[model samples]
Target: MRIAVAGGTGVVGRHVVAAVERAGHEAVVLSRGRGVDVATGSGLDAALEGVDAVVDTLNVTSLREKVATEFFTTTSRHLVAAGVRAGVGHHVLLSIVGIDRASGYGYYRAKLAQEEVVRAGDLPWSVVRATQFHEFPGQVLGQVPGPVGIMPRMRCRPVAAAEVGTYLAEVAAGPARGQAPEIAGPREEQMADMARRLLRARGRRRWVLPVDFPGAGAAFRGGALLPDGEGPRGSVTFDEWLSASQA
Candidate 1:
């Protein structure tokens, strides 16, 4: 199988590419760096010339609803249309768990729109909703400034990006299931605690402050972002991830 991975150079996308190759399948990367932009539909038709399946892990870093929604909707439309043209069979989309329950966040709202676009399209599609990645704590730390790192007071079952990648690859290798089971970490965890542990593992001494984020913070704190239903869960814990990062 020849799998085309949109945003193949990204964090999770890289693992998707690796998983595809590890499974003895060819991986076609679609990214701006490779002259293929899913958002603008530039160089997409040719990039997906012989693609059998498409794993869309494309992402946009934005907190505004309009920007995020536009990016997701446009890219999804382009991918579906191009996939149809290229005779791609399976269109697997990587989405976040609890997106339906948490429309307060701009990014979540955008993801919901993306899912809708894929479902409404003509291609055979599957939606794999996964929880936040283990790296999310570190990412949140980087976004905040000052001597103290502010952590959002939220509960999450953060799965490993690599595990999610492997699951997505397997999904793409098979027929589309429309909506696949959600994926999450083995246990629930506090985002602030994860940040503290991560910092300690890095041998860095910094004050980690936990605070409720404005606007969408309530949704996260209210557990609207946690995974629902019986879904596949990752074995890697935040502690294990921290230990590995130090190695």
Candidate 2:
């Protein structure tokens, strides 16, 4: 199978590319580094020329609804249009679990918009909603700059990016199923604890201050970000990820 991975240079996208190659499939990476911009539709048609399926892991670093929504919607439409032109069969999207349940968070709204675009498109598609990655705490830490890191009090079942990548590759190899079972970690964890543990593992002495994020994102504190009961689970734990990162 020839699979094209949008944003294949990203954190999870890299693993998806490796997973596809390990399964004896051709992995074509679509990214700015590869001279393919899904947002502007530049080089997309050529990159997706022989693609059998397309796995979109594209992302933007924006917390504003307008900015995030525009990015996801535009990129999704571009990918679907180009995929259709290339005769791509399946379109797999990596989305967040509980996006529909969450309100006030712009990022989740953007993801929902992206999903809607994919579903409304003509191509056969699959939506794989995965919980936050184990490395999410580190990402959060990077966003805040100070001696004390402000960690949001939220509930999440964080999974490993590699595991999610493997699942995405498997999905891309098969027929589109519309919506796949959500993927999450083995156990639910608090976002603050994850941040503290991540800092400890990194040998950083900064204090983590747990605070409630204002506005619609505060819904995350009430388990709006958690996966449902029947979703698939990843084996790697937060502790395991921290230990590996330290080593």
Candidate 3:
């Protein structure tokens, strides 16, 4: 099978690429580094040539709803259009679990928009919603940009990005299931506690504060972010990921 991974060089995308290749399939990377720009449809058709499946793991760091929505929708439309032209069979999207429930958040709303675009497209598509990555705490801290980190108090089941990537690869290679079972970690955890543990693992001396934010934050605190139904759970725990990462 020839698998093309959009945003193939990104955090989770990289793992998808690796897993695809490891599965004895040809992995074509659709990323800027490979001269395939998904956002504008540049070099995408050529890169997608002879591709059987396309796995989109592209990401945008913006917190603004408009910005994130535009990016996801535009890229998705382009990918679908090109996939139709290239005779690509399956279109796979990596999405966040419970984003629909937390639509109050700008980024989550953007993701919801992206999922809608993918679902409405002509090409056969599959949406794989996964929980927060183990590295999410670091990402949260990076957004704060301060000596003290302020993270939301939320219930989470953070999974390893690599596990999600591998799972996405498996899904992309098979027949399209409109919505695959949501994936999460083995154990439930608190977001703020995870952040503090992450900092402690890094041997950093900083105060990590947990706040009850408004809107989406409240939803998160209320368990809207955790996976609701039974689904695939990753093996790695936050503590294990943290310890190995720091080691």
The number of the candidate with the highest TM-score is: 3
lDDT of 2 at 155: 92
Off by over 4 Å in 3: none
> For candidate 3, lDDT tens digit of each residue in 1-247?
9999998888899999999999999999998888989999999999989999999999998878899999999999999999999999999999999898888888888999999999999999999999999999899899978789989888989999999999999999999999999999988999989998888878887798988765687788889888989889999999988888888
Candidate 1 lDDT by residue in tens digits, 96-207: 9888777777778889999999999999999999999999988888887677999888889999899999999999999999999998999899999898888888888889
Identify the superior model by TM-score, candidate 1 or candidate 2.
2
Candidate 3 lands at a TM-score of 0.98
Give the lDDT of residue 144 in candidate 2: 81
Q: What is the lDDT of residue 113 in candidate 1?
A: 92
Give the true-structure RMSD of model 1. 1.2
TM-score of each: 0.96, 0.97, 0.98
Q: Residue 155 CA error for candidate 3 (Å)?
A: 0.6
- Residue 39 lDDT, candidate 2, scale 0-100: 89
Score residue 151 of candidate 1 by CA lDDT.
88
Q: In model 3, what lDDT does residue 204 have?
A: 85
